[model samples]
Target: MASTQQSRILRVGLLQDGRILEERHLRRPGDLTVGRDAKSTLVLPLSEDLPARFTVFEYRANQYNLVFSAGMKGRVHLGSSDVDFEALRADGMAMQRGHQYVLPLQESARGLVELDGDLSLFFQFVPPPPAAEKPQLPPDLRGGLWRTMDRVFFGILAASLLLHFSGAAIIIASEPPPEPELSLDELPDRFARVLIPPKPEEPKPRAAETAQAAAATEEKPQSNDAQDKPAEATRPANAQEAAARRAEVVKKVEGKGLLKILGSSGSGGGGAFADVLGGSTGGGEIAAALAGAGGVGIATEASVGATGPRGGGTGNVAGIGELGTSGAGKVDLGSSKKEVEVSGRVTSSTPEVESSDVDREALARYVKVRLKAIQNCYEKELKRNPSLKGKVMVRFSILPSGRTGDIEIEENTLGNDAVGSCIRTVIRSWVFPFKPDDEVPVAYPFVFSPAG
Candidate 1:
């Protein structure tokens, strides 16, 4: 191998959520799944109060796999709990054991491996637990001892079941909420009326004056029954008929939640602002929506173009601006006058490290494994035979530490170390997906057949 380093090492790793990853290259996957093996350094919990399933398979003992989600290509600021599984690759500062990485829910989350130098790729997921003896109960227990234990266990289980169902029933039988009790006794002024004295009135001026007075003293209702009586005299009324008329008025404000906010007297900016919230499943009333906005007080069209802070037209604006062939084209949204800046970055879709806190049954993780790339070495062996066609099979173990353990020729239509070594290099360079385990990290065999 010409370019093979003697005592040098390269490492990569990946960590994904609770999911299984199996040894899969462009070859034999067998019973395990071929997970998304991109290189990402940071891994996070599924949620605050849950275990995260992760895999960390390795192609070599020193390296790891990295997996990244979409659009995580910037200065990732994971404050405290953000999981940096491959903190071993920390570049800038020394990683103390007590430090924490908190990942706030971002618009687009990223999985990145921060190493001394940037890596071209990384993946997530590691192997399952290594084989271990299963714990079992002793077989020598006799008669009453076992029977008593069984009975006690059954009793406790039954009690728990009964309690669960009883609680559910109690919740189901809860009564509906009582209706809001209405009382006219302490009702607010908005729902009340007053009386006023009769006065000589002119048709043109008095009619305007009536509305003006109502609009003026509208803020605080007319508490004077005398003043209220005069205002009432101007209105057409009869005792029974007036009661009916009030009912009609009440009906006018029904169905719609119309709130009228009346401001104070002369030049007090008194006005009625109605809030009519529309039910979903239909178009909304623009006027109602506008009323909700402080855009209530009307500005006459004459002053419309003169009062803008931008020294432009007074019409309201929201999203985009003028579509023109480039004159005073678009609104110079504050930042437009500044120089336009361009940005660039590099991202690997591989998984880097996974959280070991929650071990999943079927997820996988990886370790760094370097494949011996013997460039052009295969040409010598193949040229000697001249009949070396088709693929040669190679079998190897993708160590839990992400290194290539065992390597042997599985099949060879025309075998050579050059042929087998090529497959070995690929298997070593590539990552086999695996799940994370809390007890013991498992080891699995990885197989590959090189392209002819």
Candidate 2:
């Protein structure tokens, strides 16, 4: 399981529990030196030791090419007697920083090996056990051409590296002062306020008050004249009303009990009736009433005419006297049509919405189920690393109908990728309880991080 660039020592029990963790293999350079901080020589329990001495080369895609010596053959380094490595792993907990890798068994053989970390090579996977059958190749591709390029290619590579190193040294020596470090303290304060002029105070309003006072003074004289004119008009209105009342009294005396009136003639409901109010009399009734009458009253009009010889005295004394005599007059009657009026009342109504339309209890139950589903995933990570702490904010889609939709990364948020990756992988596998409408995905950004 271990190799060197020059030689290899295939040790048994390199990965005793079928796992090699890089974190478990890390050690301070000082810790590697003997005797200063050494632990007591206590035998380890049923656990393989981490590699005490090793050289690590990182390869792409989560692979490592490790090499180490077999000087302590058949004896592996002791695990930290203080810790339980198995429980930490089983719970998905991270080991300590100094604990990177584990080696279960070591082989004593020292030779050149091209062993793979994976199935085939570094950045590749190796089989758990060797293949029993040998592989065959086609005859045409089995030529010696692949072997010839190794030496020439390596020689050219070495020469180019040497030239590059010489050029880099020359550039470094020629430079003078080091560039200034980037700091916010060195930059100007962009948020500083700029200078501005003070605003002028508003003017007082004495002039407007003076103008209003002068206008009020001018209106006083005009109001006095208007009052004096109304006093003069009151006397004439009193005289005209008295004359009309006398005529109304005479008419009431003549028509008292002979005719009944519909309404009073005065404005306050007590004056005599002004219009003719009796119905037409029948001929037979009027004749019978006249038979009892001893005398009948008759009216007559006489015509006066003057002949030329009859010595007509100048009866027309003046032009003004004849004008006052009676003459035929034209008259007008008004407003014959009746007026029509419309009337109705107004009322209001409300919309058909109600609060009980949505089922609140069902919604609350669904929310609880979702929260529990998410909490279960967090417990898995905590069990693995009790010391692990972080908050991860993930922006993923929940469909309008409540199904899981797109899963995406929410950038610029708190999270540990080691923990986040596992959580995300497991959450995408869950099934939701409801179907969403419109299939429109809504993003929920959930966060998890260290409590501190």
Candidate 3:
């Protein structure tokens, strides 16, 4: 019975201020310690009065012993009797040397040991807990892949793989042979025409016709009437015929109401108007006088005839010659040449950093790389006003995530609101390569000018 009790395990429990903290089962021949130290078997809350470590229970000579250190207060229960540490020391039942007392503990002994009146340790011998059973799957459910997988599914998968490989092999082996390559020289004419077409032949000039055309162009300045009129009406054989034609045209003009109308106005107004009309007897002379007076003129030359009155004149003059036979000539109203268009250039200067954590060189490099995008903002506005050229200073902050925020135009000598707004929008999209510990303030300036 003594040997059987020695074989049983000792159960030790720790209490803090009378509240149970933890319990542990110790086998025979094993020692137990309790203290605030981490290596102790039973650890307790740290206290100035408590020692770093103290052996509370010891197993020796096939028997368990209880140890009481100095300042420790407790009672030991043996069977139906109780013995205090002081009583044990007085009766010499417990061995005492210096500041510690040892009492042999029986299998049925159980008691509480207090440390500084704050911590208590309970100890006793008890049966050990039952051994845990090993986990296992049921016999019907346990097996390898053959028993677990569907046999029909596995067979179908194998058949499908075999058919796929067989079809691929048949198609590859039965493919048609390759055609022979042909040289460019041996190719058909149709292909030759498609690949290398013949150059078109330029028309050759006729020397006689060209010479006559050059002489005609040089002799007479090109006129719209000359181009529109019949060859016979455009050129007369001799001066006599030309003079005869001019007299005929004058006679025809006088036959109309033009002279009578002018004479009637002159007769009423008198002055130079009457004298000029009254003195002009011949229609040719009158037409010349009207021409010199900045009025309607009749051409005596065979190529052109009478024309409409100059300035603002009211009268329907009949027998005014053919449609393309009369006109002073073509007058240049304005130039057809285009005005030169100019573009403006946009550039940025080095950025000014106002942060201790952000790297100046890195910030400048990032700004330089994205400077083109910023410049694009100004250049878009610069296109509208070529003279748009000035400095724009932008203020912004780099967040901890390296993204820009609070972007605003601090100074815009450029004086264009659209440009400033565009710059702000562009800067807001910029993200630096580095993340800052805190937000960093930055100022950047840009200059714009028309490209020379």
Q: What lDDT tens digits, residue by residue, belong to model 1 across residues 326-345?
A: 55556766874663332211
Compute the lDDT for candidate 3: 0.77
Ranking by lDDT: 3, 2, 1
For lDDT, the strongest prediction is: 3
Rank candidates, TM-score, best first.
3, 2, 1
Candidate 2 lDDT score at position 370 = 60
- The better-scoring model by lDDT among 2 and 3 is 3
Query: What shift in Å separates residue 299 of candidate 1 from its native position after superposition?
Result: 99
Q: Write the per-residue lDDT of candidate 3 for residues 372-398, one digit (tens) a residue.
A: 776777668776877788999989999
Give lDDT: candidate 3, residue 118. 65
Residues 287-399 of candidate 2: C-alpha lDDT, one tens digit per residue: 22233447533312221223211243544322333346578786756557754332211111221112333234553444445654555455555555444444444445445
Between which residue pairs do clashes occur in model 3? none
Q: Which regions of candidate 1 fall more than 4 Å away from where they truly are?
A: 1-380, 429-452
lDDT of 2: 0.39
**CA error at residue 181 for candidate 2, angstroms:** 99
